[model samples]
Target: MYGKKYLFFISFCILIIVASGCTIGESPAEKMYEHLEQTVSLESGFAEVQEPLIEAEQKEQELFNEMLGLSMKEIDKIKKLADEAIGLADSRGELITKEKESIDSAYEEFKSVNGLVDEIDEDTLKKKANELVETMEKRYKSYDDLHNVYMEALNMDRELYEMMKKEDLAIEDLKSRTEKLNKKYEEVLKSQDAFNNLTDQYNEKKKAFYKEAGFSTTDKKEAS
Candidate 1:
């Protein structure tokens, strides 16, 4: 009877060992790092697409300044530069659409991650996570708002330029339209400044998070 009982107990232990395998859950810091990595990657991609638009605008401005002192013979170069800038904007539509979708999806994941992150043993780290999430939400929303207004202004400016070229209008009429376009541009600039400031704050918070996790902050640059 004793022999049979001992054999039965050993079989039970073997079955239990076979049924339960070793498993490891990710630490809170690891989870946050993954989220940060994805967010930064998406932002970097968007910024790469956006860089050409910015450079084109700068080149256009330089051409405009040079054209001011030159004769009408130089107007062709200015027009070419302007067209290039507009083309840059047009070509980025698909990229921007994809980036918007990606960022939005990431933002949703960030929200879900927030709940899990509270389990972190460190109270300060949890608080920082909450702050970072809130800042990111605001930053993305402001960025979207600023981009919409900037595109609207760009389209209107182009339309006004075409109207001036294709049809003769009174000085007063053109002036009124120009003033309106200037106002729209001003609005876009204001939005951009706001967006930039928010982005800076986000970068600072991100650096703080990395520091808290004992990760290197030097490799993380601010995404524009």
Candidate 2:
């Protein structure tokens, strides 16, 4: 009878141990280990997802800053040209209709560049959280010397157009210069047009870039 009682007590202890663990057939140590392993796996998975996002965001931001620094250098050059044009226009009989049109076109291009540069702070920063602002500043000076040459050409087109229109200039000389001026003028227009188009494309392409990055852009426009 004492043996029977002790056997009952041992069986009860085993039942209690089984009930304390989560599963029917599993031991407490095994279940505890499984729970700990699952916790670590979840933490690892979460980190894996976050790490790439942070890296991609940084890459995208670097590109953006590169682009913006290129833009600000561009803006400064354009501003200088605009100021020169404005000063020249103030002079007597300095600007005519076609020359004025070229000046207007150049001014418009400046405005477009200015607008894009101005949008960099809140809108772009929010979208490109990991971007390096300092990197863009470093890139700005490199593009300046190259971009200045193109800006100079834009100014020359306006100036040459005015020079040839002088009443003192002979028709033969004007005729000869006209072809060359027109060619240079066309090239300048083409470059300015490209810059304008790129700005527009960049704005529209934001949605696509954001979508690819798994961040939803407002309105979520589909990429073509």
Candidate 3:
């Protein structure tokens, strides 16, 4: 069974406020930050959707373990567990789709900031903004890769469950499938690591960009 990897949500505490004598006009950096905030806001449901999925996967793992000890005479119990596992896999698929849609929406919202980047007047700030955009793009791509690999592993898990329901299932066949599932999970872990690394990089670059743009930021933990 695959273990759950918790994804870090990107967040910041940049203070956006108008000074007492300042005009109502918003700077380009402020506008860009607004769009970025909207992008991050779209991902607020990520944990809500992900938790149930993880729980479902854990339940399926328990089912797999239970099925292992059943004899041919207990085939009815085996089929019942297999059916439950299949249903869990289907539910997981739906949750994953929702997860993908959430990220896709965030990516679309983030894309709006690319145009705003050019409006930044300060050369150094503009350069940093560009770097931030590029890193975010890469982070989004890494997540997509992670999603694909995870879905592949999910399908493999489902196939293994289906095999379990078969009466004449060969031990060698089950062994082979289990090996493949393990390898697929290894790939999933690798992809997950890549996504997390990119996310960390993006967060650091984003903080630097905010600082260079004169946005007063405090770490969220500090504020708390």
Tens digits of lDDT, candidate 3, 1-224: 23322222222222222223333258888787777778767866554676788788778877888887788679889999999989998998888888888889989999999898989889999999999999999989988998898888888878888888899988777777887787888888788778777777777777788778766665332100
- Sorted on TM-score, best first, the list reads 3, 1, 2
lDDT-superior candidate, 2 or 3: 3
Model 3 stretches with alpha carbons more than 4 Å out: 1-25, 219-224
lDDT of 2 by residue, 1-224 (tens): 00000000000000001122233234322332233223323323222333343343344334323322333336444344434443432331122222234323433332332223333344543343222122222223222322343445435535543543343545455445545644554554454444444433433443332333343334332211
lDDT of 3 at 147: 88
Winning candidate number (TM-score) = 3
- Global lDDT scores for all candidate models: 0.56, 0.33, 0.75
TM-score of every candidate: 0.69, 0.29, 0.87
- TM-score-best of 1 and 2: 1
CA lDDT of 221 in candidate 1? 43
Model 2, position 20, has a per-residue lDDT of 29
Error of 3 at 69 (Å): 1.8
RMSD of each: 21.1, 32.1, 4.6
Better of 2 and 3 by TM-score: 3
lDDT of 2 at 196: 40
Query: For model 1, which pairs clash?
Result: none
